[model samples]
Target chain A: MDNLSMQKLLWGVFWITSLAIGMVVAGRLWHMRLLADVSVRSRVQQSLQLVAKREGWLISDMSIRSVTPDAVIIEHRQHMRGRDPRVCVRIPLGTLEILPCTS
Target chain B: MLLRVLVFGLLQGFAVLLAELHRYLGVHTDEAKYLLNIPYPHPPLMRWILETTDGWQHQEIFWRIVFASLLTQGTWFVWDMGRKLHKDQRVTLCGLWLFSGALLLQAGTLFMPTITAIETLFLCWILQRIEFLKRWSALIPLLWLEMLFVAYQGILFAPLIFVALRQSGIAPWQRWSAFLIPIGLLALYTPTNPLTIVATGSVSGMSMGMPLEESVARVLKLWVIGGSMALSVLGLYGMVKSKQYPLVLTLMLVTAYIFVGFRSFYAILFTPLLIAGLLSAPKLLKSSAFLLALQIAAGTAIFLYVPFPEYSSARSVGDALRVAGVHGDILIAGSFGHEWQYLMPGPVKRYRPDFTNDAAAIVCLDRCVAIDRQAWQRFPQTTEEVWVKIRD
Candidate 1:
């Protein structure tokens, strides 16, 4: 084979090998992006529960409906130890509000 | 089936190599030129291909043959990966076709974040189908590595460390250490290449600018700069939270260019990686329709934002000249005055670059040049006015 032709063939082989490996690696990254893990979400939920108790407030309900980078939503009815919740607080996107201890 | 996949695997390597070669050979002109200078993200596998082909010089037949081989191999690699990942031969072929279509729309348009986004989404697909954690374990390191790169690129060190620790499922120290490897490597790499810091900074809305007093101009500046920061942050955050890597990468580009002074079109390079990842696994796509829609909508928004004809067309400059009014025969000069050629069917001549004073183009566009007062007097008959002038 001519020198140039042989060189092209060799380069092709090298290129093929590296990209193949990179693609496999790139593929796994995609996998990580897809699955949702419980580590952080669970911690947040647990903390909320603890706070709810200290305030003498009963969390009427708590659920993980949707989680995006902007905000996390937990739906709960507020109730003091003896009283039912008549008021609800909805936080705006990018805002944080501390719930009342009396709940 | 194994061979089909194996062949495609090889093509993926060449595709990345070729993408890099293209970056080496070409560059974007105008503002993006000085603003950022990063190596194409796919890592220029094609240059390696070209280098290896050195001995094949002087034989046209073989040269053509190798050229054709690379293209065919790249396409097949894409198709095969799709098939294997999807666990369906038909989907693999369709995915390949879809990828080819996207590449045809634009190839070797290598910006790292966009490509990472698409690849991330595709990888997520592969992970879902993998089912067996043991089989997938070998691949997770690469996933971590890319995120490490993203963290460094966007300066998201804290959250990246957080995610790596949370996902590692190991003891606290082990997880923390896993996160540190990337930082260690990143530090070694960044100083060794100070260019990336400057490049990333310019494209991250942290461009170097002189400090100034609080005034109307400063307030306007803050509004512009702050607004860009907010947009970039939002776009990146939205993609990450959605578990859509492609979208995340897309958002990165959106934020970087709009807020950080990079081009949105640069996101094209991610096309191949996206093709490889998404095509690899297809069935899970049904649930991902929202993400797909989001990407398209975002892309459309950018397109609607097309400011004018590109610089090369001269049409954009002609629009600028029209804004200047019938100041007809005088030679108008600016950094990118060649554009005035097409803009001014009237006698809109550009002043010589070196000869023209700094205030030279400020007469046309307010490009903050210290136009010498003497030079301004030279064109006494002419005056400066703010008009909806053309942009590069």
Candidate 2:
């Protein structure tokens, strides 16, 4: 075979391999995005509740105020400190964990 | 023609949207540096461009738009060059798709050297097409702009321009004069040795310490990360089959340049050339549409789902430092010192252990800071602590 034919064959193989890779990547990304959406809110709320409980506050008093792509803002009223004040905690989504609901 | 315009416009819009997403996530270090107008290692043109839109409100968004525009324009130029090189509209669109899909878009999301490198390539392509006599007049300003924007990497482009001139059938004197103009300007304006910048690996922190096997692996890893592994292999085969030796040589040189430096972001510099080579190969013509669609799909998926971590902690640290009444020369000690130096308002000093006493406050990475609760108070409302020195 001539050099040109060989080159053509190599490119043909590369394109097939690229298509396979692209399909796999695209499929994986789709799965991950689905998982993220399904679990992100519950995961964030559970973590916030755990932190509140650890701080000697009731889980019932704390609630998620807002959730953005990068952060989750939680508003909670602390009654144990003898003064009822609403405290807002902003946790980066990247740092948020999926803690068990111990309460 | 309208279809072409619409398609390109949509691609540009998608590119801009991806850039906007990046900006919203957080201010990257380079973006922060440009925002603060800090003297960076690269040329000042990018900073100056960002400075024009500087204001207190939504400045990051403004900078993102500027960056997006640069990438969009660069993509358009690639498409334009593709059209000039190949008759097939599919090939042109595929080239554009390949560019928009690659890590080049991610690099474009920030104010980095990658955008300027792309712009330099665009200008070189334009210069290559211009008539010799006409190019002489155009060459001087183009070279100056390239130098002013890209610094030492701009000099690597000289051989490409030289090849372009040689192919133009211009007389030896004319070609020499055309080339000499830029060299003269570079000598007059640039103080340091351009070659020294490359030798030192300061361009992209690429140096020559790793083993050859490791270096090749690093390059391959970068190629994969950039989402161009298969395209690059195809492009390489295409370049060889087409016998475009100059381009092949230049691409090899650039790959080596990035390989030695080993900066992943620098992989963007050769993307346009790779795409061009791929588009030019006749054998790949049938696959162009499939490749283009797959790339666009992959690009869109990555843009929507991939989480680009923004260096937002720098801003929080800066704000905390100010609120804590820390003033004067602040010391930043960490891997992210360059970012802290840029974000900090006042005269900032990067940490050296000896100069720790000179700072009013020390912004050390959590791991790097010594465990001393008595002498330092950690600032609240920040992921990273800003340790203000206790005043006696």
Please list the C-alpha lDDT of all candidates, in the order they appear: 0.37, 0.56
- What's the residue-level lDDT of B108 in candidate 2? 39
Residues B191-309 of candidate 1 have per-residue lDDT tens digits of 32223444456554443353433233433332222212222223234345556554445434434343344343433323433343343334434434344444444434433442322
TM-score of each: 0.34, 0.63
Cα lDDT tens digits, model 2, B1-392, are 99878866876775667666675566666566565544344554566566555544566666666666665556556555565444555454545434443454464366464664565556545644565324344333344444544444566556666776566555688567556654554443332222223334554454556578888887775554344455666666777888877667767777776676665455566665665566557466555666666666665665465445446577677767767777666666555533554456555544555555666777666454453567667766777756777788
Q: What is the TM-score of chain B alone in each candidate?
A: 0.39, 0.76
Top-TM-score candidate index: 2
Off by over 4 Å in 1: A1-103, B2-102, B109-122, B129-138, B146-169, B187-192, B204-258, B268-392
Residue pairs clashing, model 2:
B206-B261
Point out where model 2 deviates above 4 Å. A1-103, B1-9, B25-40, B48-59, B82-107, B124-141, B167-171, B184-206, B224-227, B297-312, B319-329, B333-335, B350-361, B366-377, B388-392
